[model samples]
Target: MTLTSQLTVGVAAFDRYLAICHPHKYALVITRSTSNIMCILPWILPTYVILGPMLGWRNWYPGIPCSFDIIFPKSLRATAYIIVYIVSIITAILYLPVLKTAWRYYQRMNKYQQNQTRDHMQTTNKMKKAILGAKVTGIVTIAFSIFWLPYMTLSSWIMVSPTAKSKLESDLANWLVFFGASNSIVNPIIYAWKRPDVNQQFKKVFCGSKPVSHVEHIKT
Candidate 1:
C-alpha cells in the first residue's frame, strides 16, 4: 500500500515535469498506452516483487500461525525498507524539475501584471496552475514520510530487539500501521483539494452540481 500510494505522487510529479519543463512534448509522450502502463507497473511490481517473496518465506518461526498480517521477519523487513527507500528516492528526484520550474514561473509572473495583455493573462494562469500542482505534490511527499517513516522505524526496531516490549509499545506500533495505511485514502483528497482545476471536478462529483470551469483537469 505504501509503495502504491507513493507511486501516485511520482505519477503526478512526472506529469508536472512534462507540463512545466517540456510543455510541447507532454501530449506526445503521455499517450493513452504509456499512461496505462505507468499506472499498472506500480501496483504489479510492489505486490509481486516485494509482497510476493515475503509471503513465500520458508523459514518461519515454528508455531506461528501462517497468516498474511504477521510482523515481518528480519530479512523481509529489511527488503521492504530497501524497496520503500528506492521508491522515495526516485520520487524525490522527479520533484526537482517541478519545483524549479514552479519557482521560475513565480519569479517571472511577479514582474508586472498591471498592464497585462491577453497573452500575458493566459501565461500567468498557466503558471499559477503549475505552481499549485507542485505545491500539492510537495504536500503529498511530506504526508507520506510523516505517516510511514515512524512505523517502518519502529517495526525494524521490533525485529532487531531480542525481547518483546510493553503492551503500550505494541499498541502504538499497530496504530502506526493503521496511520500508514490511511495515506492511500488521504492522497486523492490532497490532489483534489490543492489544485484549483481539480477542486471543481471534486465538487461536481460529490456535490452533484455543474462543473465550475472549463479548466483542464490536472493529471495526478
Candidate 2:
C-alpha cells in the first residue's frame, strides 16, 4: 500500500507539475476538467484488472472472499494471476522511461552546477531545480520498483515454485510490506530531504514568509 500510495502521489506530483509549469498544455494533454478522474484511474484500474474477477468467482462459490489460489477454479485463478502479472509488468515497463529521462536530466543538471556566472545564474538555477525534481521523481520511482518487485515476482512464481512457504518468505514479505508503507512517508521525506523548492514553497504556504536559501533548508 505504501508503494501504491507513493506511486499515486508521484503521479499526482507530475500532474501538478504540468499544471504549474504548463497550465494551458495540461488541458490539451489530459484536461484540467478530468484531473481527479485521471489521477484515480491508475490507482483503481489495478483492482479491476486483478481482483474484480476474483470477487465474481467468490460469488459463484460460498465462503471464499479473497485469494489468488488454485481452489478458486483453474480458469478463474489462472486469469487472475495473469492479470496480476501483466499489471505488474506493465507498471514496471511504464516507469522505465520516466526513470531514464529523470536520470539523464539529473546527471546533466548535477554537472551543470559546477559553474554559475552571474549573467546566466538565474537561468541555470531554474534549470537545475527542474532537473532536481526529475531526479527526485526517478529516485522515488526506483524505490517503488525495489520495494514492490519482490512481492510481484514472488506472486508470479508462487504457483510454479512451492519454495515460497519457507520462513524466509514470511520475513521477505514483512520487510517488503514495510518498504511499501515507506512510500507514503517518502513524498514528505523527499520534499524535506532532497527537494528544496518543494520544501520552501511549503514553508511559504505555512510559515508566512520566504526562506532564504535552498541549501539552508537541506542543511537540517
Candidate 3:
C-alpha cells in the first residue's frame, strides 16, 4: 500500500509536468481514457509485485511466519529493491524539471503582474497555484524518501549480511517498518495543510463551526 501511494504520487508529478511544461502536447495526449488508465496502473503494478511470491512465481522462505521480515530469497529480494530504488530515482529526476519550469513561470508572472490586465492577472494566479501544487508534491516526495530510506537501507544491509541479524537488529527493523508505514498517515495531513479547501473541510468536520474567514483556495 505504501509503495502504491508512492507510485501514485509519481504519476501525479508526471501529470503536472505534462500540463505545465508541454501544455499543447498534454492536451492532445491526455484524454479521459488515458487518465483512467494512469489512475489504475499504479495500483495494478504494485499489486503484481507484492503478490508474485504468493502466486508461486518466486520462492519464499519456509518455516518463517509471514511478517515484515525478509521472507524471499536474497537474490529475489535484491532484485525487487533495485527496481524500487531505480523507479524512485527516476521519479525524483522527473520532478526536477517540473519544479524548475514552475519556478520560472512564477518569476515571469511576478515580473509582469504590475502591468497586466485582469485576464492576465487571473492567468498569473493560476500559474502561482500550479507552482504551489508543485511545491506540495516536492515536499511529499521528500517526506516519502525520509520516512522510507532508513528501512530500505537497513534491509539492504541485512540482505548483504544474513549473519548480522540479531534480536536488537530485528527490533530496530520492525520500528523502522512501522515508521515507514506512518508516511501514509502523514500524506493526508500534508495535503490538508497545503490545500485550503481541504483545510477548511477538516475544520468544519472537526470543529463543528464555520471558519472565521474564508481562506483562498490553493489548488493541489
Evaluate model 1: give its lDDT.
0.74
For all candidates in order, the CA lDDT equals 0.74, 0.57, 0.75
lDDT by residue for model 2 over 121-197, one digit each (tens)?
66545445554555565566666666666765664565466464566765665576566666667567866778776
List clashing residue pairs in candidate 1: none
Task: Indicate whether candidate 2 or candidate 3 has the larger lDDT.
Answer: 3
C-alpha RMSD between model 2 and the true structure: 6.4
TM-score for all models, in order of appearance: 0.76, 0.53, 0.80
> What lDDT does model 3 reach?
0.75
Ranking by TM-score: 3, 1, 2
When 1 and 2 are scored with TM-score, the better candidate is 1
Residue 124, model 1, lDDT: 66
139-179 in candidate 1: lDDT tens per residue? 99889999899898887787677886667868888799899
Error of 3 at 161 (Å): 2.5
| Top candidate when judged by lDDT against the true structure | 3
For model 3, how does the per-residue alpha-carbon lDDT over 87-186 read when each residue is reduced to its tens digit? 6887788888887887788687668757898887666666666666777877888898899889889889987884958888889988998999999899
> Largest TM-score belongs to which candidate?
3
Looking at model 3, the pairs that clash are none
Task: Give residue 13's error in model 3 in angstroms.
Answer: 1.5
